[model samples]
Target: MKIDKGISLTKVELDRIEANFLAAWTGDNSTPFIVDAPISASLRTRGTAIVRQTNLYTLFQLCPTLATWAVLTPLAIDYGASNKNVYSHISVFTNKNFDDAQAREKLKERFRFAARRIGLPVVGNQPTELFFAPLGPARSQLPDMARAFVGAALHLGPPAVEDTPSARDWQRRAVATRCPNLTRLNATISFDRSAYCARRFEAWRRGNEPLTEAEALLFAAYDQAVIGFGRHRSDLVAPPRLFWNGFTLALEAEPSQSAQSIKLGPFPTQLPGGSQVAIRTPWPEKITWTAGSIAQDIEVAPASDEILVFDADSGVLLTRTALETKVIAVASERQVVIASEQFGVTSFGPSIQSADPGRFIAWTITGDELNFPGRLPPWDHITSRDGALDQCRLDRPRRNAYSFGVGWRVDPQNRSRCRRPNQNSPRTIR
Candidate 1:
């Protein structure tokens, strides 16, 4: 329980260490198993069940096939009088019976240890991502993320558009306000390690040394098929809400109420290949989307809500502080202007330099925080340019400063201290 100060680790770090160990040796997402959703519904998989190749115990004599080595394995075991938390039931369904009120309630939610390899799921690298869901790869994003008057016109400069998440699943926190009906289902089962194997792991835990390949050969890979039923729950009845269809918008099933503002934002939305997304709302509702600057009451039913759809526009949003004025630079005879990539957004350029389009004196910058770091009170500026990147003509812009608006939180807490970002951030004519 108590380790040397030097080796003591935070809970997250300790879990990470165990996860790495599991991934290196036991991260086999291919093992076959089954689980019950409700008491009546069962889920199964395809793979070779883990079984011992050789039998050395008396079970073979008593009943050759009926009492296989797997049958004899204990669910858990202990040695000393006190072995507090030696074996963890991490992410396993402790209560497998859904019919029992208490058991189902207990099964309602169980934390998954970061070491998912200990459980029997072939999870990919990111444990945060779930393998099973009703949806497939999302081709869209949420829409209009600016914390300020997002659905309305600019309060300061332009609409602040932030970075977005894949439309596969909405973030739980952001979706909470929309009051969407959410159903959760968990499966109960632990098919990776046996009680004796866990006891061995307890011993290994002290030494902090992994088993040698030859040492590992002595252990047997085991499996079981006694997964019981888990649990499920639905959200409380609430206001009508809109669901991201991964490409557009759809109304959730709810008793229709007239004149409701179905907020479609707080998440930035986008479509693949930069195609326009047509928002489809439920038919027969008098919809009114009103913000400070723009209020549109459009009732386009049995049809996509193109003009009224919050996520409909795919144009790059300039920040509220963005300049209303415009600056145009014309490139000719191999001379060019440029826009560089930032914040995962792709970009192109008129090259003072050239990959293939030829070269000229590249458009210059005063400063770049990311690509080029500046010094002395950190004055960011372009000293020279072999080729040019757009948007660099201003700030000596370190990427942090460049990203200040649009997606960044930009110190909202300090809004009272400094309201509008007083910067010379400029955009090029794309």
Candidate 2:
């Protein structure tokens, strides 16, 4: 009854059973017990000796289910370190009734399945030289024999689905919690970059470092605009193209010291399809003028505490802000302006007499403040100069705003204008 050790069957008994079965089923002298019958008497004697010693015959006698099967023990020579060889002792059991062509096809199919399960490249019909390279440890190898046994068991009794968290579920939760603000700006962000940001945030939380004004602003933007409220809404509006345009302009501009002469404009004159041409002076006295003719003479003058933008053709002023800040401008069909102070990057739009004032978007570099407008701000709010002054409101107060940890800490030597708060101490914006 112990099947693992196998049963003993004499050659005479095996031959007799085969003869009886052949006689009863088909009137022939063929025997299914032997594979490739001997041609000469001497060869026949040698094959008979080999057959008696084989575990295949014993396996059949021990397990009645294997009676109609042929055993193929595939020996794989695995190479180890230092040119040493390690032999893999493996076996494959298949039906004996299968023809040469059927057996070959079956072997290949099994090999392909095993290769795929182990993340290996499969070859057609037979294994190629490329397949022989040792990919990993032999213990992790999925051979055809294991696949066959496991497949047969699973087919008979399939496993139930367990109530456990899957990879997809984890990914969904991560995307929802990490960068919800990005959902509105999804087209502008790459998945790799978002994942990287998530990792950075996690690292910052663990280390407890102070965040720079730019870092704090970007983090708050992702938190307020994306994760906190953006993803839940079905009708999310796209940020304005001008907002991004202005933001890009500010990002490219060289960082200047306080009260330094930073250039603001030499922006293109014409509107997208309009005839108006524009020109502007550099910082200290930031002024812009747009006219129909490029040859029109206009005197450029610097103003100490004001940033001015105007359309000379219509003699209409677009925007005027008197904040003590550094200014940078981008000119096109529409005017874009960026102003950076100790707090963060703030954007504003131009005021056209008949049109609504431009939108505002600001990212406060200081952690203590959160400015969420009743409406979603324009995308280009970070770079635009229009409506910049009206949008500079400290609506909400956040404690420990800049405490992301060591990775985001602003060096004290560079903290000339901005105060460096204690990393562990909570701070509030007025």
Candidate 3:
């Protein structure tokens, strides 16, 4: 036999090299050295695995490869802007199987299962449905899962559902159930529909069926929540206005007309419990609000920390804060009089009596003095008919001041006070 030394290899040496290669391939490095060669090779292996998978089972068998692709594709592929590549791959896989529906259903079931584990909902059951459907233990329990999914989409946002026939059917059912008339009256301002709704309210008002105070308010407010009517133009619902009863009670306990004008410095701050907050508005009807989910109505008191007045159109988010609850008392139709002792700043501990009203009219009490006070009358003096004391007014002839204190003996009348605090005075009279 002609023996070629070059071709002759001992089993021991062959085995030794094979062992080292296998160790490296299996991610066991003999030394602490890192090699780019192995990483590139590993990526090639993953890419090939994704391309070669014939079915969901095989695809799952290559889960490590699939997961690797899932992470790298968003970076390596222009997948976010366009999902054509992934969709094409799925289509090809589905086509290879004789029954497309079965293949798709299997894939969806698996993929949705995975999505739910990661907090994302599955898109849909149909190929055309391009939106994601949220996963839930009882998502399918709803009368129409797809419609519930669509309604959830509208409410929460991010139309992750596919625009498939089944998804559309689901959306139709959901819309019919939740807000049957909302779609028909998308942006209507006419009171036609409101007038219809009012009939139900009129029934409730006429005692045909008793309603809770909140339910009644919601009924009336819903009728008024139109774009061109009732103080606002949007139909967004706001949370009920909130007033801490404990805080209001504290202010009520103080002497009458004991409107404490504490000024909170030049910033917003959370007041302690029992601080008075007085909100005001001209809507004539009281607004109901909920704090942290407990429903309550705004009240005319002084102990609440911060009063929020909601405009009827927009929901609670559009509520404006007021410095005081005092308004021009509607005692006579011919004229209106203002009241002194406005609510003070919420951010700091000073009243307008001690601090400048600042440039922010929103932050200042309504009756407080400012550079160009809106609708402000002038401030003047009025001699007490008893000839004992004098009162101040926002315009002239103090009509009302300290009805609970020294000025109480002067006039039972209430009017805005324009008395500038004496710069050198710092007396706290009991």
Better of 1 and 2 by TM-score: 1
| Off by more than 4 A, model 3 | 1-99, 119-132, 135-237, 241-430
lDDT of 3 at 191: 12
Using lDDT as the measure, name the better of candidate 2 and candidate 3.
Answer: 3
List candidate 2 segments past 4 Å from native: 1-3, 6-77, 80-106, 114-123, 126-134, 137-430
Which predicted model would earn the best TM-score?
A: 3
Q: Give me the overall lDDT of model 3.
A: 0.28
**For model 1, what is the alpha-carbon lDDT of residue 70?**
23
Q: Can you write out model 1's per-residue Cα lDDT over 78-136, one digit (the tens) per residue? A: 11123322122211212122355453333222211211212222333221222211111
Candidate 1 is scored at a TM of: 0.18
Estimate, for each residue in 257-371, the C-alpha lDDT of model 3 and write its tens digit: 2122221234322323334444323211233332222232333221222233222222112122222212212112121111123322323223332111211112222232212
lDDT of 2 at 95: 19
